[model samples]
Target: MTRREAGLTLVLMDRLRTQRLPRLQAMHARVTAGDCLDAHDLRYLCVSLEETQRMKSPSIDTREAIRAVLARLYHEITTQALSNEQARFRHAAH
Candidate 1:
């Protein structure tokens, strides 16, 4: 996706994370023994989700921080990645 699209997506993701993430966490917590997620896996998801939310902060400084983070993430994912993966990251979110 383009940077504009990615920025919009990041905004939407941040809005949803505060409301949806906790519910998702609760559901996994309530799952039975048959279902399990390792610490690393869960932590990765949490961190990723947190970044999404952080990117949409009302503060300008926070937005700049998120933009930097997004650029790094975009670069990391685009070093000969699939088309879809490339479409999923933004070089610098405006």
Candidate 2:
């Protein structure tokens, strides 16, 4: 992605992360209750953990932060696509 694209991606990701906070809180509650997570839930939890780790890293230049955000966006897109496909297959099998 171009620098502008990466910057846009970061903005979108930030918005999405903000929007997802409630869902994350719900997931945390579920985990605290000792509930088991299904495959999709597990994947989301893993991605959230990865994102938290990335955000906690030492601060970098604007360009580097944009690059890191872009990488994270790509990772999330790929994982979401895979998860959708798996869900479709499971639904089809039922």
Candidate 3:
């Protein structure tokens, strides 16, 4: 890769570590704690996923690692959301 491309890759990786990863981790923790994600939180996740698709890092390992983390996050978020929906349904049926 060219020097400029390498520089961009470094910037993307740094942003992932310093900015995106922390936010994602926090969301994962919140969902794991049984808190239903709000619409804004869901929207952010969608946008983040879309942005991740657009990212072009030269490191296959880094991309795979990010994808794995995202998959886990998606799972937890959906699981919590499902639990919340079930609780609401039960509440309404009573």
Candidate 4:
């Protein structure tokens, strides 16, 4: 790869390590603990999902690993969120 491409990839990886990874890990912890995601959390995830679609390029070598974690997070969060909604619906129905 050219120097510029290498530099950009490095920057992207650094951002992933420093910013995205920590936040994702935290959210994973929260969701795994049965806490519902707030509006800001949902919005952040929505934007991240959108960005991930756009970020699928050759330079970002760790994309698959990141995506795997993201998929797990999505599963946990959605499962909890759906459970919460179902409980609310049942409560209302009663």
Instruction: Using TM-score, give the best candidate's number.
Output: 3
Candidate 3: tens digits of C-alpha lDDT, residues 1-94:
7788778667877877798778988887877676677889889888877767756667788778878887787777778877977886888899
Better of 3 and 4 by TM-score: 3
Q: Model 1: per-residue lDDT, tens digit, 13-83?
A: 66545754464444344332223344664575566656565444445686677567645544433332333
Pull out the clashing pairs in model 1.
1-87
Candidate 4: tens digits of C-alpha lDDT, residues 1-94: 6677666666766776788768877887776665667889889878867655544446355768777777777777777776776776788899
Please give each candidate's TM-score.
0.30, 0.38, 0.75, 0.65
Ten contiguous residues with the weakest lDDT in model 2: 51-60
Q: Which residue window of length 10 is worst by lDDT in model 3?
A: 49-58
lDDT of 2 by residue, 14-39 (tens): 85467545565565455445444468
Error of 1 at 72 (Å): 0.4
For lDDT, the strongest prediction is 3
Candidates ranked, most accurate by TM-score first: 3, 4, 2, 1
What RMSD does each model have against the real structure?
A: 15.1, 9.9, 2.2, 3.0
Comparing 1 and 3 by TM-score, which wins? 3
> What is each predicted model's overall lDDT from 0 to 1?
0.50, 0.56, 0.77, 0.71
User: lDDT order of candidates, best first?
Assistant: 3, 4, 2, 1
**Residue-pair clashes, model 1:** 1
